[model samples]
Target: MALMIISSVVATPSGNKDISVAIEEMERANYFTFVMLINMVPPNLFQGNVTFLMPSDRSLSRTMVPAQNSVMDLLLRHSIPSPLLFDHLLHLPTNSMLPTSNPDLMLKVSNRGRRSLFLGNVKIVSPNICTHGYSVRCHGIDGVISIEKPGLASPITCPRVASAAAPLPLLAPPSPSPSPSSAPASDPPHGAAYETSGGVRPQMELALTTWMAFVWLLYSKAKLCV
Candidate 1:
């Protein structure tokens, strides 16, 4: 079936220039079906930053075109909320997930190289086709991206290893008490030398001096008698 293009102009408050430039770029790339799909959607949706993952005309011709009411959902699922260039997409590692404009949908990346980048099931055949627009960018894909269900396995799988319990801290042994002989001696208190029991050497010296004086007196009396 031939896809119809709406010739009627849709009024937009701003960002008309970027969208017009982007649509022109898509047309130049011969993505007429995608351009027609873009025209069917409201102009306000394309006014914000967005990246379109456009399926090629040959690929779209094989599948059925989306209905008028569901066109917005199809477009949103194929687009990213933020403007991402082909170079930016190459930075995403394999198995990384990108959130689509639809909150419930996610695009799984399989980036092997520049030529081998795949989003979901669709591989980007043409990179950076709509780079002329500031807020809009697009890349042509080989096929329509498949929507992943929320119940499926998560994009990243972390291994579940049992966490080992933390080890207890070691306590240091108490130091041994010093023996009396090994201990250092402190100085005696003042006036301790004058006490009777503590001053025995001083008392003996005083008695020896008094006995020598009495012996010298007895010798002088014996000399007088001779």
Candidate 2:
């Protein structure tokens, strides 16, 4: 943004004047709110040859001030970048569009004879409040011009976000099965003859041999007696 240095000078009838004089005229016109608003602006702004559309005291008092970011936008909407007086504006045909400091907004002129002149929705109640200088000009308007936000005029669209797909979960391995041959053996009953390694029991065989020998001895004794 370029800086506008306002230098004060007296306004001559020949279209030569200063910005400070114009501001003084605004104070005299009972536009205290409008004057205060302009004073709030930094010295570096609204620097070039400019025109101001000031709202009346009552109009400014009733309306709330715009936010800090919006204050510049609002001021720009009301002002024309070039110096324009009531006479210059009067020549414009009906529906003539005038550009402001802000490119998005415009001031439309509505000329309806001596009774009324309008810039957009607000009527120029007091025309040419300050025409003392060639660089600065001011006029009193009936109401405040509605400020349209640049963001709202052209809607901002958000780009689509790409999301990554989720990863799959892992599972555990299964256990091995047991073999049938490894099962336990069954138990045997009590008092049964258990199998030995070589032959039959020795006690039964000895008893049979003794009985045979006794029989033989008795036979021999009987024979000798006869």
Candidate 3:
């Protein structure tokens, strides 16, 4: 969808500026949430000088994350803490990562040309949502921006808190990790006779005894003849 740029509804630092053009621009681009966020925010809180980085409706719907994840945090990750337009953005090196309010700790930004601005790895389909304000530039991206992981798995336990009541310890920093060693190792059972102690049948024992008797008789006869 082609975004509509409206100018009457926008808020700015100097005075309230008409954002009817940016509004129309965003509407056409299908950035419904971005429009709604701006419209919903308390006018005074966002009334000061600032730039907004907005995502499209499609962008929000495409994430693999659960819905409870704060949409506001994700929005802030895309927005620069300061007001910066494309022309000003040019000074930054390409492939530079920017900081954001999200705990994820980082957001990626790369510019291919005046044509597009990428946020986190997503492509911006439409930028400069409102035509009236030079400070605010809106770009539509293919996906949502990234933030620092809210809670990550830890391989090691964190240090315990110390208190006036505590166990005594006689310890230095733990020694280096133990050297590798070899020993008998338990193996998966794959062989036959896992639990049996003897032959498959008792008949085999009698057969061996009969053969021994025949050999002894032949030996006695030979000795007597000699």
Q: Which candidate's TM-score is highest? A: 1
lDDT of 2 at 55: 86
Report how far residue 60 has shifted in candidate 3, in Å: 1.6
lDDT for every model?
0.74, 0.66, 0.52
How accurate locally is residue 68 in candidate 1, as Cα lDDT from 0 to 100?
73
Error of 2 at 207 (Å): 99
Question: Residue 177 CA error for candidate 3 (Å)?
Answer: 49
TM-score per prediction, in order, is 0.60, 0.56, 0.46
Which digits, one per residue and each the tens of the lDDT, describe model 3 over residues 1-226? 1232234333213434534455666777677777776665445434334555676676666755333335454555665655565566656566566655443455555667766666556565655555466444555656665544322211222332333224333233223344335423453232122233432223344555665765565565555445
Misplaced by over 4 Å in model 3 are 1-12, 15-25, 63-69, 101-104, 115-117, 148-226
Score candidate 1 by TM-score against the native. Answer: 0.60
Cα miss at 32, model 3 (Å)?
1.9
Model 2, 1-226: lDDT tens digits are 1232222232222232366787788988988877777667776566648889998888877777677556666677788888888888888888767778878777666888646887778888788888776688898888888745222123223332222222222322222234246444452321122233221333334445654564555555555435
